[model samples]
Target chain A: MDKKRKYPYFIENPLEHDRVRRFLDIFSAILETSNYRYILDLYSRVTMKCSRCASECQIYQATNDPKDIPCHRTSILLKIYKRHFTLGGWLKAKFTGGSGLTEKDIDEMLESYWNCTGCGRCVLYCPLGIDHRIILRLGRYILSEMGIVPKNLLVSTREQLQGETHNSSKVPLKALQNTVEFLEEEIEEIKGVKVKYPIDVYDAEYIFFTPVSDYLVEPDTLMGIACVLHEANISWTIGGTNCDGVNYGLFYSDSILGDVNRSLISELRRLRAKKILIGECGHAYRAIKDFLPTYNDGEKIEVVSIMELTLQLIEEGKIQLDKNVIKEKITYHDPCNIVRQNRGIEEPRKIIRSFINDFVELKSHGQYGLCCGGGGGTVAVDETNPYRMNVAGKMKAEEIKASGADIIITPCANCKKQIGELIQFNKLPMRHAGLHDLIFEAIIMKDGKKHGTDD
Target chain B: MAQMIDFFMKPFFIFSVSVMILGLLRLFIKTIIEIRRVIKTAGDKDFKYTKIFMATLSWIIPGKNTVNTAVVYSIVSFVFHIGLILVPVFLMEHIIIWKGAFGFGWPALGKQAADVLTVITILSGIILLGYRLFSKQRRKLSSVHDYLFLILILVIFISGYFLPKTYSPFNVQVNMLIHIVCGNLILIILPFTRLAHCILYPLLRLASAVAWHFPPNAGKELNKLLYGEENKKI
Candidate 1:
């Protein structure tokens, strides 16, 4: 029998002190006086009672504790703001429930803030219309500055930043080159084409950034991009360095998280792509769609999600998709980061509908979509805490079962992995497919012949 | 009679009115300035319409929704506000006083309608207060200050409804005076409490609309800023 597993609560870990300190330092630096004041003012004005916000919070509902409410989490940061900044706080801190900050406060803040996946469901329901998730991010930023980040996540983020890829596999240039060569050969053998996987092509109109999974386990998704780009006859190239777009740094704090994005942006400028297309990764899309604009100082390079681009190509008659390419009855899982956080519900559906004839919809598809439970770098850590993962994935698993679709197609790499694990754990019949795989299968070649074989 | 008249003629009344007007004017100016800032920051053209529509609707909608579920409470609250406005300005007694003070006399709604509105407003206010205590979601969000304000409103509304007639041994004139004073106090506190949402809601909606449109991204050199480093990687 498999050994009983323990939940990997960061507080319970032996290396908690070192991890906590590092997180605290990073968090403090980011929440310097100016940023703190600005965030405090935003939080102050955003406090309002809305039942809609309460209705949307799954964690709060699951726990049945108002403390678990997103607004209550916001209140933790708001209390600090009250104590340090607000005038009302100066007059009656006790009455307002504001008090002197302590180490215990820091510990609780770390635990609660990290618990949130930053899915942004509350932003949809806020009546006064606050992005509670952004406030939580600010809390994460402060925590990260203090060196209080969770160990497993922090280690992965450090590796990704240092190695330029999240996987311990540490895909180097040689591996990447070999993988591309292998993909090219596979396509030639499978689809009868000698198409090139251009590396560092100068001044391409599009610079495609994808998660490392596509290069390793899911070559078909990359080939799908290749097939679509070929059919559209679009000028695009992949970067030789920092080719992986998935940014785990975003899960930690903005400053650390921002480096990967900044690098991607700077690379896009050098290549001079009219548009930068992000691959089928949820957090990568969220970073680009939501966070990138905030940091952007006036750079206007169009950054489009691959699903969005696929839809655009279909609309412009650049690619004709064969519906029968994916014969299995399929349902789409809208990754929380992409759907709720980025508000990218329609484009992916359009792409799916265009490519597959029997595409079914999950009940919680758009703003209400369940998290794959592996977001915010949960998938990367060893599955030491299986119960947390299972409990988190409960909603998603139930929805998948209810859908009765033979295949679950998610445009996000993280979602694909999480759902795959969930399916395996539950002994479900559903198999997982990336959105790009279907797109690849359906693409008609330049010679008016379908690229992918039925097998 | 002479002493009572002197009490009625005290400068406190004039001071209160002046202060209220000043506060209203200050709030109006501040609201306008903030709205302009939002409009200026709005990046997209679509936000312009959204801001305008939200600002307009905030004033038009009264009592959270049109069909008030808490009927008695809604009636009481609505009446209290209408009475607070009408009894001070349009009632024959106030009109005479106003004409003496400012040489202006305006058309007034009939006493029956005025009475009905006042009762409805006061009743609604009370029901809402009760709802706040009983409702789970509302109770969760409510702080002590929220409960205090609700009780305060309940007192003012209930007192205004029963003054000089049902429960008070005080003279009708004295009771009415007490009701007016307490009602005004509530108004003064309105700006500081959750009641301030009335004024802040439209402004916030406008800001959201503008922020949504102008999204710090439109028309700027996003490509250059985003892709500058990517070229090196390429």
Candidate 2:
């Protein structure tokens, strides 16, 4: 095979081609002049070279490859920084003329940076507290700008940004409304109660934002959320436009992330919603609750997680649960963005314990929980599944299998899809559930009827 | 040759001092300014000084956190760093040199204690170097500067250790010159190389968001900026 064709994920010998080189030069200049000052400071710091992060990285632990170590993985980009950005690097280039990045170096970065799930477990153990995940994100931004992103992420993000539906799945408002109506009818038939999956209700207190996939892939969580809101009598509505809370730019591109987030804010403003109630999608929750406030200042809308709402409702006695509905040994998978990144660690577990009698804890749980191997958009990228399973997901699978749990509950949509697939691929006995799914099962609705009873 | 060595001694000492002070000042001012600018525009105004102090202190002390995960390497590194500081600050010979140069000196460590510390420092440097070379993981991350810095420190220690004894294998004056030059070179490059960690570690703890644990509002600001929260309207 030609060396040019070796690394298909990245553009070949970027500096060798005029168009690619121009893009690199322009992007490099942008980074040099833009909001990347903090990142530049971070990369310029001396790596203590302790290899402390290797033991903490699941990828390195599984592969035993030094190159997979987070610091080593990041050092590839640091080397580029040193060669292009620093004074010593400049002097070395002046004297030796041997410090410029080559095509081979670009290829290596593409291979290493994408292999990481941006799970950020390494940040916990690093003595200097380097966030290697940011470097991976920066790498993704640069790569995405060069049109070298994974096919799935590129397609989804593009569709979400520029498509007619303004969602990655391209589910139109009609389809979304139809799905919500279907769930409403299904819930009514099962529980002998009528609930509204309200769409674009003006002046609602809460504007509910969730991934479009919730309307297609799994609606159990959606129904659970509807039941909780109905019982609590909260005025919430999903917007007709920009209902997607997912900002894929969180995974790959800053521009896309900004555009997607801004659009969501516009929708919220249009609906005249007072607060943004993000559903049980981890990255979506993070993008809205954490990233939204930063991106859209002066938008005084208070954004919060659904767990906070459910927990608050349960505490107020507005939401009641049977508690005995779930009897199997169940474990919870803490989504990286929620637990470590957003501090939703306890709330999700609290909601689960309300319904589950036999809750088994995975050995690695909470802030240090192993990633579901599908974080940072890896779940969306099909090109890396073999690596995700055999390497990134290995420790997580072993942890799940060892817990001997019959069901695993995760609040994050990405984790739901990733862990569900992992169970199928690894042949584990456990099935995956959303926290809302279990909550849907156990929560006592106000109409004095259980699910599956025809009126 | 002795005259030449004596002639260069004053200038070399002055040069090393100037380089060390100026280089460190530049690094410190730049880092502080950058941090302040970032915080003013994008980060939380309130900083948890106590948290920063504790986090820096925890990392400075030996056997706190590193002991749990990296036992052997942490122990060796801690011993080496402790000895490296103790010998330089307390050794009688170094104090005597300081007294001669600056007319100020402190009480020095006993000769026997200095000897033991010197040996420990030398051994630790060797062990650390060996670890870097032999451990495939570390070796992959190791660069030319890593090895060169280790070699420089070892030479400084080795030459200083023999400077007190009547060694005949090589010219004593030459050995003295090698020790002086290597030590001076280290001072000149200290701010430029990974050795800057010796000074910047604590500052990074205070200034960098990753290293600080702040109040809730501060955390929100930090999350907004570092996590792309500030890019949107709050």
**Candidate achieving the largest DockQ:** 2
Query: Candidate 2, residues A1-455: lDDT per residue as tens digits?
Result: 33334443433233335433643564474454344545555556657767888877999999998989999877777777777767777888899986477666666766787888888888777777667877777766666555566777767776787778888898988988889899999878766679999888999999998888888987999988999999999999998988888788777665565577778888988998889999889889876665565456534468888999999999899999887778889999999987765388888778777777889899998988999998988887766777778988999999999999999999888999889889998999879988888888887888847644555
- RMSD from true fold, candidate 1: 7.0
**Native contacts retained, all candidates in order:** 0.10, 0.25
Give the DockQ (2 decimals) of all models.
0.16, 0.25
lDDT of 1 at B122: 62
Kindly provide the TM-score of model 2 when superposed on the true structure, using C-alpha atoms.
0.89
Best by lDDT: 2
* Candidate 1 local lDDT, A16-87, one digit each (tens): 344434443443433332224443454464465534455557666555666667877887777766665567
Which stretch of 10 consecutive residues in model 1 chain B shows the poorest summed lDDT?
B217-226
Q: Give the best candidate by TM-score.
A: 2
lDDT scores of the candidates, listed in order: 0.63, 0.77
Error of 1 at A340 (Å): 4.0
Model 2: lDDT of residue A190: 64
